[model samples]
Target: MQVEMQDIHKAFGKNQVLTGVHFELLPGEIHALMGENGAGKSTLMNILTGLHQADRGTILINGKERSFSSPKEAEQNGMAFIHQELNVWPGMTVLENLFLGRELKNGFGFLKMKEMKALAKEQFERLDVDIPLEQEAGLCSVGQQQMIEIAKALMVNAEVIIMDEPTAALTDREIAKLFEVIDTLRKQGVSIVYISHRMEEIFTICDRITVMRDGQTVDTTKIADTTFDEVVKKMVGRELKDRFPARAASLGEVALEVRNFTRKGAFENISFSVRAGEIVGVSGLMGAGRTEIMRAIFGLDRMDSGELYRNGKKIKVHSPGEAVKHGIGLITEDRKDEGLILDFSIRHNIALPNVEGLSSKGFIDGKEEQQFVEDLIKRLTIKTESAETSAGNLSGGNQQKVVLAKWIGTNPDVLILDEPTRGVDVGAKREIYALMNELTDRGVAIVMVSSELPEVLGMSDRVIVIHEGKLSGELSREEATQEKIMTLATGGE
Candidate 1:
């Protein structure tokens, strides 16, 4: 099937999301839609998938004019949309979720459980996946759930599928498997609209690329004819330079220390220390105890036994309140769920950590709160509408900045960040690195855990590797290499 969207325009109140953007997908080709956060990639795809109607646009399918009223209509017409956030129900089994909308029914109007399972199993087999069909989707890993979503698309014989950031949470092995599946689909004459911020994946899987900037189409080019530098320049409309900022010049005394941190099967004897003005990058594979360690320090998760020290004095953190009171802040991996309350305004999120300072005897000083939020928002370059906009309403990058603002407002001595730039764009990533440099320059200790090797190598002053819930090795910035990090992460001597 051939899809064409011409002269698309969309707006939400005063925000002009898309401005006369044009996009197309040819049959059996992988077309990459590349852009930064708030560059209108999601809005353009939303319009194509029938989730939102473009204020002014025209869509044609195989030379026939069509406007879908719902996602079902689009699916029925051979179009499928895969969102960045997986849409599987944690409580439902894989078989149940696969046939959720279009379930097989028996003559008695009851669900045909056997038929559904058989079909789901067949689809899994077709995709070369060995998933537990009866297992609850929530129990499955993120990569397995993603494969199930692809199988859902296959069940409907979707010819044109829009996959948004499909590999954001996947490990290296899972990503390779996903690429294999994408290759199979391509051979089946299935057209794919792949969206992502990762440069290497775009060049690897996409045959053609289209760049969008500030709600308009910048240029479309083939992978063979264009270079990475050119594509990045087109995306940001800025000069090409390094993605990671310069590291801090010097380090201070140890600010945070953890000794013999034990959590049974989760992690054991985990120990590390961070000096002021230093960035420590924790590198590991999935389930390597990196996030578990951070959570324990921040009081989100408890350790069976451990010793935590702040400024050389031993302390205990039984809850998150205590962590914050001790001048410790955590920017969680999933910003939408763990970091911010989506329904609250930017001001509220920034003020949440400092409520005690802004309140007196349970009474909040509105003037003080406003003044504080305004200054922080300006300092952080958070792109929001007057600090009154809801955090949920902001783009991915700006939302991350808001998360940073909230943490920085707490005036923390030690900060913990987990996968800070997981789904953010290039421009936002550079900004975030610059922010880290700014923070460390002021002698704030930082512990960062990232799965991206480039990020770990580029920003970390020291790199620590974990394997199977144990500390593998540590390397200084001058000594660390991606090969060495991987070796340690996989239990090398």
Candidate 2:
């Protein structure tokens, strides 16, 4: 099967998101879509998957023109899209999520639970996914949830599979398993559209690549014919000198210390210290308690026992407000759900954390708020028309930036970033790395939680690994290789 989009054009009111975008995917081949933050990749995928209709263009499935009225229609036509965000119901079981709307039933009109469970188990075994069939989806790890999503697509017998940042939260071992599954799908003649920001994964799996810039198609070429630098340049239209900035040598006194941090069923005995000018990375599997530790530190979750010290002085943090007042900031993992006020404009979102700073005598200073937001947008290189633009309308990467800008406005001494670059593009990722370095250089301590090992190794001055709600190991940047991190993260240490 071959899927092609010809001259696709889509717009929302006066804003054009996709302009004359063209792409093609051949059977047994992985086609990658590369672009900057707001380059219309998601819009185009939405159009293809029938979530949005193209204003003008033609979609040909197996060289036959077709129009889909809804995502169900697209799915019926052998197309499936695995969104960047998982859509499975947390309360449902794996079998239930796999056959959600299309459940198999007997003539008695009852759900065939046994059959569904057996089928789901077989599918997982075939895909080498170790998700439990009867377990609640919410109890599963992020990587396991993703595998369930893929299994659901396979259950539908989709010929054209569109994966949007499928590996964003997956560990190296899980990613390798996913690649193996993709290979098997390709061998069975499935046409795949792989969207991702990680260049290494693209080069490893994709056969051809299409670069989109500002809603327009820049170029399409074979993966073997282009270099990573070339693809990145085409995506952002600029040369990025370095992905991670140089770390400063001078270190101030310990800014934050957590001793005997214990959270029942989450993490225990976690002891770590962050210096004023250091960036420490916590790397682990999806359920390895990395995010849980950060959440506890920021007072988002209750801790059974922990002693926290700031500059050698013990302090108690009981809430997010207290954490913020104590010069602590947290960038949550789920930006859409926890980080942003989507109804507000960029200026409003950026001013949210530091609203008091922008207010005077019970009235907000609009001019001061605008100036601060403008400066932040400039500093972060957020590609937006103006500060008045709605935060919801911004791209995923820009939205993440807005979250960062909002936190930075609070002027925190310690910043905690959880999956900071989860859905950002290559260019935006470079900017974020540079910003992290700049913040650390200015005497701010950073504690980063990420599933990406390369990012942890590249950006952190020191790395800590957590496994099954316990601190497993710690290493300096030089000692934190992919193998060592994996070993420690999986409790091999």
Candidate 3:
């Protein structure tokens, strides 16, 4: 399938999302769409896949102008879109989700369960997936859920598949497996539009690249014809010198310490300490209890046994409120669900944690609240029309920034960040790193949990590896490397 979008123009209300944007997809080539969070990469793809109709444009499929009414119609015509957020029904079985809405039924209106199971198994086998068909979709790990999405796309016999940040939740090993599957699909003449912020992955897998900026196509070039620096310059309209800023903060005494942290069936006997003005990065593969330990520390989940020390004094945290009272804040990984209430305004989300300070006689000071929100928005460089804009209306990077601002308002002595830059773009990531440096400069201890090795290495003063449910090894910044971290994360000596 060959797809060509010529002079696509789309707008929602007065906000123009795409203005004369253009994109192309070849039959069997893996073309990458590169852009910042709001650069219109997703909007262009959404138009192509029939989720949104273009106000003015021309869509040519195999050189014939065509338009699809809905995403289902697009899928039926050999196009599939695997969204970043998986679309699996938590209550349904794996097999059920695989055949959802397109189930094979008998003449009497009975489900063909056996046939569905066989077909799903065939797709799973092709992707080297080992999940049980009868298991609930919610029980699977994030990596497994990603595989399920891939299998579902293949089941539709899609000639063109659009994958949006497909490997965000996957482990290193799982990513390697996915790449292998992509290689096989390309050999079978399936075209893929791969969208991701990871530069290494794009350079490694993509044959051609198209860069979009400010809702317009900036440059389209072959992978071999471009460099990483050139791509970054095009995406941001300026040269981004260093991927990470320099850290020059001095270390202080231990700010937060966890001893004998134990959560049965989750993680066991995890011990770590982060000092003021220091960053301790926790590195591990998916489902390796990295998130579990952070949740326990933040009082989101119960730990069967553990002792927490703050400022050299033991303390008890039974809930998130208690953690905040003790000057500890947590920025959850799932920002959409745990971090922000999407329906609320950006001012509301930022002021939620600091209500007491902004209130007088149990009534919020509107002037103070507005000024506070505006200052943080400007400080963080969040692009928005107004502070009253809904947080849901912001892009992925700006949403993450709002979450960070919310935590920073708490004036925490110790901060725990889990995958802070998971869905963010390169430009926003650099800004976040600079903010981390500034926080540490103010003597705030930080613990960063991440799966991206480059990020862990770039920002962390020290790195700790977790495997299964226990601490494996720890390394100083001077000694840590990707190879050593992976070795320890996999329980090697």
Candidate 4:
């Protein structure tokens, strides 16, 4: 199997996202695509997977020129794409989702359930993923859901597989398992197109690397022949000074405190404290209530019993409006669903929480709103044509910046970020981390909930682990480690 894309050019209206991009992949090789945010990586992949048509290009599969009218056409031609966003149906079970639109039928034309379950189970085993075929897909963790998506592609025996940021939300162990599976597939003559921002993973797993910058292919090289610094230079066209900024503030008195926080099945007795200018991180497995804890604190969900204190003063919050009024802002994990209104313009989204700040006598002051949004966009360094651009049209990294800008407009004293950098490219991830440090230096406390161990260990001033709806353990920044956190998270302590 071989895929050769020649001089691919794509444009949306006046935005020339992809320009003469050329790449090739061979059988039994894992090829990694590297680029910064809005570097035309997604556009090129979309063209290859048949999600969008290129304005001018040639796609040759196995030495034959071909046209893919739809995703089904590409799939029929042994091509599969697992998008960065999971597209599984929550209402359907694992087995049903695996065989949807192509179910096996008996001679009587009835649906064949037994055969589907058996096949689904076999596929799960082949990937070494533990999931119940009869269980609803929604009930599973995000990592398990991702595994199911990969298994679906494998069930069709795709010769070419494109995985976009597959390990963004996976733990170290889960990532190891996924890499093992990819290696196995490669040995079976599968050609994989891997897209990720994790430099180490690309060097470890990919056989060949292609660098794309500003919608053009910069260079292609073998993993063994390149270094991380070289790849970063090619991706950004410059040297990156420090991924994480220096923390300059000394910790102050406790700024936010939670006592006996309980939400029944979600999380319980989650007592923690964040001092002024301190960054506290909550690390746990998916479904272990990391995000739920953040939501509960931000008043998105009702708590059965809890006490919240801000600056040594007890406060009661029952709604997000109250949370904002009390100087609490939450950046949700699902940015597309809960953070931003896709249909709204960037100015409208940024000024949502702080609309009152831009109003005079019950009427919105357009000039004031525009000035505030412009300042925020500049402060956050959000890449956008203008503030009037729709939030949905921005890339994943830019959309995340909009979410941050929206919350920061509220001038919250404590900010809670749930999976803050998930699905973002490496350059964007570095920018976000630097922003967090800057916020902390300005005396704003931050609480981060992340599934990535390295992120939690690297950024947090203190670490807390939750297991089975309870606070498993808490460790200071100096004491927290991968092994220690994993042990506490898995209930070993």
User: Could you say which candidate leads in TM-score?
Assistant: 3
What tens-digit string does per-residue lDDT give for candidate 3 at 1-493?
9999999999877778899988899999999998998888888888998999999999999999999999999999999999876788889999988999899999999999889989998888877788999999988877788889989998998999999999888888878888998988899999999999999999999999999988999999999999999999999999999998988769999999999999999899999999999999999999999998988899999999999999999999989999999999999987877899999999999999999999999999999999999999998999887898899888878899999999998889999999999878899899999999999999999999998999999999999999999999999999999999999999996
Q: Please estimate how well model 3 matches the true structure, expressed as its whole-model Cα lDDT.
A: 0.92
TM-score between candidate 1 and the true structure: 0.95
lDDT of each: 0.88, 0.90, 0.92, 0.89
Candidate 1 C-alpha error for residue 144, in Å: 4.6
Model 4 residue 166 lDDT score? 90
Those runs of model 3 whose alpha carbons end farther than 4 Å from true positions after fitting are: none
Candidate 4 least-lDDT 10 residues: 241-250
The TM-score of candidate 3 is 0.97
Worst 10 residues of 1 by lDDT: 240-249
- TM-score versus the correct structure, for each prediction: 0.95, 0.95, 0.97, 0.95
Report residue 205 deviation for candidate 2 (angstroms). 1.2
Report the lDDT tens digits of candidate 4 across residue range 1-493. Answer: 8999999999888888899999999999999998987888888878887889999989998899976888898999899999877878989998888998889999999998888888888888887788888899988777788888888998899999999989876766778888998999999999999999888899899999999998999999999999988898899898787766666657888889999999888888889999889999998777788887888888998899999999999999999999998899999987876899999999999999998888999999988999999999999888887899899888888899999999988988999999899878778888899889888988899999988788888899999999888899999888999999999989888
Report, for all candidates in order, the number of backbone clashes: 0, 0, 0, 0
lDDT value, candidate 1, whole model = 0.88
